[model samples]
Structures are given as C-alpha cells and as structure tokens.
Target: MLYPPLHHWLLGAVGEGRLNWLMLLLAAPVQFGPGLRFYRTGWAALRHRSPDMNTLVMLGTSAAFAYSLAVTLAPQLFPAGSRHVYFEASAVVITLILLGKLFEAIAKGRSSEAMRTLLQLQPATARVQRGAQVQEVPVDAVRLGDLVLVRSGERLPVDGEVVEGRSYVDESMLSGESVPVLKESGANVTGGTVNGTGAFTFRATGVGADMALSRIIRMVEDAQSSRPPIQGLADRVVADFVPLVLAIALVTFLAWLLVGGEAALTNALIHAVAVLIIACPCAMGLATPVSIMVGSGRAAQMGVLFRSGAALEELGEAQVVALDKTGTVTQGQPEVTDVFVDRGWSVVDGEQHLLRLAAAAEASSEHPLARAIERAAAPSPITRQPPSRRSLATAFAPSWTATRLRSARRGSWRG
Candidate 1:
C-alpha cells in the first residue's frame, strides 16, 4: 500500500501540516454525509427507547471524528508531539461501512427479484368494452366488471370470467400446465396468461393488485422478507450485546482519563476513542447472517432448501440415513415404466387390460403418467401421439362392458 516516493512526500507534508489539512477536507464529507446518516437513524432508534447496531456504529464513528477534529484544530492542547490527526481512520471506517450496506441492499434485491419480474410480465394495456364502445386503455384503468378483449396472440391483463367467445390460454404461472387451457364462456382466466389461437372477451373479476399474479408476487415477497423460526446464535448475542457494548465504551473513556492524570490527558483521550472505534462489532454481527444467506441461496439454486438455521444445524449432525422414496429418493421427474396388479385380478389379457384401464382413468388428466399410459395404449407400436380422451373412452368401453357382463352371469348362477 505504501509507494516509496509518495511515503516520503507524505512525511514532508506532515511536518509542513499541508497534507494533514487536505486529509481533514477529505474526512469532512465522509463524516457529514454518509456517516451522518447513521447518526440520524441511530438517534431515531434511541428516541423510541430501542437502540441497535446502528447506535453502536454512530458512537464509534462519532468518537473518531471528534478526536480527529480536536487534534487538527489545536495541536498545542495535546501532550506535546502527540498531536496526530485520525481523519483517515474515521473516513475509511465510515466509507467502508456504507459500501457494505450498498452491497447488502443489492443482495436483498436479487433475493426478491423474482417477484418484480413476475409483476412485470402482465400486459401493460387492455381492450375494454364499455357497453358498445371498445377502447384500448392502460391495464390499471380496467376495473372489476369491465369486459376485456384478448385476441389470438395476446397476454391477458387481469383475472376475469370469460363472457364471450372461446380460446386456449397458457396459465403456466398458476397451474404449471405446459399445454394451453381452453377457455369458453363462463370459464375463469387469470392475469398474465398468454392467449392461444382464438379471440375472447372476459369480465374483469380481479384487476390491479387483486389479480392472481399480483397475489403470487406479494406471497413471494413476504416469504423472502419473513425471518426463519430459529435465528442464529449470533443474532441473539448481538441483540443482548448492544447495551453492554455502550456501557463498556463509557467505562473505557473514564478508566483511561483516571489512569493517565493531566499530563497524559491527550494520550488518554486518543486511547479511549481508539477503543470505541475498534469495538464497533460490525464483522461479528454480519458474519453469521451473510454466510447463511449466501449458503441458502446456493442451496436453493441446486433445488434444495433448509426451513431454518435449526434445520441446517440438524443436517450437519446427520449420521444415520434412511431414504424415503417420495421426496428424498426421487430423480425429480417420475416416469411410469411398470404397473402392478393385485393377485385377485384376472390376468388372461393383463397387458391389454392394464393399458386400457390406465388409459381410460388417466384420459382426463394432464399428468405425465397419464400421457405415458395413453401413449402405451396406441394401436401402432411406433405412434408417439397421445390419444384424445373421447377416443380413449370409446376404445375402453366395450372391454369394460364385457367384463361386467361375465361378472353378472357368475353372480346370477351363485344366487
């Protein structure tokens, strides 16, 4: 950090007191601008009878600034030859603290950016039907009971009930359905859904923040803002440590003054200020939370999440292991490769029977297993296309009817 020539230049400037005054000018803004913000916030906290880390920060930086100011203005008032300025100390400390806060704000923003991005996905405008006249207006202007028109290729601006026409709308955000949903008269559609190949007019039931997408965004924001059930030990320590730290700072100043009588007053004062600055406790306070946030974020990216700090601690202590098939032993996306039938069931045409039954039951569902069974029931071995629900119902109806007839015949003979 030391440049040889710059160091020599500083030594000369110190003797002449030129560089010292320049440092004072540099320290002024650091103390009064960003650093003064701490004082304002900390003072507000004190007025409400609740002081925190900000209070400690303000006291530390203030002590350093006051000492540096005294040293700069009156060199003769000090213990002769001990009149050194601490402008650099106070300035660097405050600036670094502010920089840390800037980075923390950015981190928090990124943590909840998903909500903002979702909010932005809704269309900006809507075609509203006010009696006979249809006009394009801002989505915000669309109100409850207003009829909003959506075309073949458009995003719905608000949650509404379809009043006229019919179309397929993609509602992946709400239902996680890959296929577009058919929306006819009386069908409900949500905001942010993409319209498929048809035109429709719907009555707005939920506009503005009342829409499903808006509620989802708010939900995500709240989840990110809520604290976990069990907080880290460090957070509890910091909560109780504030009052103790302030008391220690007062004791430090008085103890130094008593130890170094009158001749060492300047030395005593400088030592006291140094103690306060060193005892700011920012690193101790930030260490646990920062590490947890970063670690949790990384885990979430990998598709894993801990419910709380307590959960993470329990995970660290795990020695014995039992793999549950439902959650812990998944390949993430399940597939239907095999089927099991009970021993009492007839198996003469097991393959065909199972395929028909599965396809028939799953025909109305959009789940992957349903699609897989429907594909397996296709007549052609190479056909990859899924059968329609109507076709599946037609195909399975005859086989099921014959099985019921045979069962009835056996029951009549027994009776």
Candidate 2:
C-alpha cells in the first residue's frame, strides 16, 4: 500500500490509468524470470500430493498477475467502475520473498565464524626428538610414541604422556582452571595447553583428528548441522497449513460467486487470491532451523559448546545452571590481597621484611600462589636473595632460609 502523502501526490501528478502500461512492462519479467523457481517446485509438490509453501506463493502471485494482465490488456470487458490493474502487488510480493531468502543465506554464512575460529587453534608444526637429535616437523608428521619436546611458554603440539622432566601446564582453555596443573613424569598433557617455565619431553599419544582440540571442533560442526526436535513440530504444522488454506480459498470463491450480484466474478477472484497470499508459510518454514544453527554457533564462540542441537533446545528448559567459579566468575590469575605480620617482631617495616623473605623463598617455585607472593613483594627496594635451585630439590620446600640486609629495607615498602 502507498503512504498517504505519496498516494495523494501521485494521483495529483498523473491523474489515473496514465502509468498502468509502465507498471505492466516493469513487472512482466520479474513475474516469469526468477519467479520460475516457485512454479517448478510448487507443481512438483502438488503432483506428490503434499503441496507446500511454494505452491501457495505460486498460486497467489500467478492469480494476481493474470487478473492484472486481463485488466490492463482488455479493460472494456469489465464495467467502468471495476476496471483496475494490480501489477505492483504481484511484483512486490515476489521481490520481498526473494529478499528474505537472501537474508537467510547471509545469516548462515555469519554463523560459521565460530568453526573458523576453532580451526585456527591447532598449531602447524611440532618439535620431535629423533634418536639423539631434535628436529622440527609438521604436526601431522609426528607419529604415535614419538618423543615431542616442548619448551617453556609454548603450546603443546598434541595430546601425550610425559616421558621425562617436569613442568606446570595452563589448561584453562579446556578445563577452566586458572591454576597451572603440575605435569611430572607419566602425567598426561593435552594439545593447545600452554607450558610454564620448564622444559619437558612427552610421547605423542593423540595426534591429528584424535587430538582433544580437533574432537572439540568436530563436536561444534556436528551441533551446527543437526536439527533440533522442535523443528519436527513446525514441519508437521506447515504440511497441514497449505491444504487448510487451499480449502478456505475454494470456499471463499464459491460463496462470493453464488451470492455476489453483478461483480461476482471479480469479487470471487480477488478474495480467493487474498486468502492464498496472506497464508504464505515462508516464516514458519525458516524460523526453527535458522534459530537452532545460529544459537549453537554463537554459543561455541562464547566458549560454550553444545554437544548437539537437542542440547541447545533443552538449555532453555533449565532452571538452575551450575558454573565453575574460577574461570566463569573470576579471572584465574592469583594476586596477593592482604598480609599480616607476627606481633613479637617489633620491626618498623615488619610486613615488608616478611614479604621480601617470602618472595625470595618462593622465587624458585612455579606455583600460582608463589607467583602471587612474589608479585606482592616486587615493589620492595631490598635485593631478593633466592636459594640455589641445586640445593632446593622441590618447588615447595618445608623450611628454607634467605639472608636479608637491614640497610636495603629503609628506602620504601610500596606493597
């Protein structure tokens, strides 16, 4: 329908019937060109005894175009008051439906961003130990049981069991634990986890598609392709809706033809076409599948992977969701917040004295709590005297002594 101002302006400028031929010429190609898809699919659906939304669109637009063509080509057949053309109605409906399809395609393209991001996580190469020599090779070239050497501050190339040495691994990406996990001999390590400041060699146990990262990517792909259970209900209703609308349109045509007086033919055709056009099932057919795909993909992007489409649908039914406290609510990194000093010391800078000693004692430790203590004492002006690593066998020693100078402490304690 035209807006009030535009309708009034058009009528004032051109009167009436002056632009009907131009409209008919502009609409003819659109009615038969890309619109051919509707006719082909609609005819197939009707032949199979299961008419669908395509059939309804085809019938509605074709009826409107046929009647408008009749009116435009031979206006004298109808009474002077009933002669009218509706080329715009038929053409506009096809254009709008095509535009909706284009938008749906664009949404499908955008939903794959999560999968692309997941694929980007896997490293391209790995360092493998060959007999007495170490060589770098493609990740896929490393075989099971091959000894893979990983240095400090690097991502693990594949899932494997440690063969020698010790380190702490940050598995927060997969396990949601902020604290770095200890990886001693025989301990298992996963691909994509970052290693702490220690070197280690591990036997490759899972590579290529069998790696944990690859399996997670596969789960995301499966979840995106799967159809949720709710889509079945929509499919059933749409199957029945087309036939119900066709029956109503037939009844409307018969009622108008028998009861309407001089304008019975025009009245029947117009009302019947209106019922079919308004009952198009484009939205009903598209809503369920598109929502499922987009929802699953967006969830993966947010670090929440749905196992399947059913999980995505069932998520709405949950009343209480249990979440991990470390990674979900707080940053996994630990930092010292408060410290208290012993009462009997009577030292002016007792807190700084204790913090410097604590930081030196923990300087060789790889634990997160030790790092937090070190960070807290970093501002103290005193030179930290850390114990020898050769003497300290374990990261957390029961009792270790570090000599502190009283002169270095007088500058400032900024903790």
For TM-score, the strongest prediction is: 2
In candidate 2, which residue pairs clash? none
The whole-model lDDT of each prediction reads: 0.70, 0.76
Estimate, for each residue in 1-415, the C-alpha lDDT of model 2 and write its tens digit.
4688986677678765666677788998998997888899988987998776667778778877887777778777766766767778778877766765664455445445666766666678899999999999999899999999999998898999998999999998788888888999999999989999989999999999999999887876676567668766655665687788889999999999999788888778767877876776556545664565477546645667667768878988999999856555567788888888645455567688768777887877888888899889989953456745543323223322221233237564222
The ten-residue window of minimal lDDT in model 2 covers 395-404
Name model 1 segments beyond 4 Å from true: 1-9, 12-17, 47-49, 76-84, 108-116, 127-138, 147-153, 162-169, 175-187, 195-202, 219-243, 261-264, 284-415
| Candidate 1's TM-score | 0.63
What tens digits encode model 1's per-residue C-alpha lDDT throughout 1-415?
A: 1577885777776763666677889888988988888899877876776766667678777887788778777767887667777777777777666665665454455555555667777998999999899999999999899989998889999999999998777766566545467899999999998887689999999988898898777765665555543334544554566667667766777777788777556666777777778877667545445655676566655534343445554665689876533424444333556767555555566576667766766666544455667777765242334455555445455455566577688885211
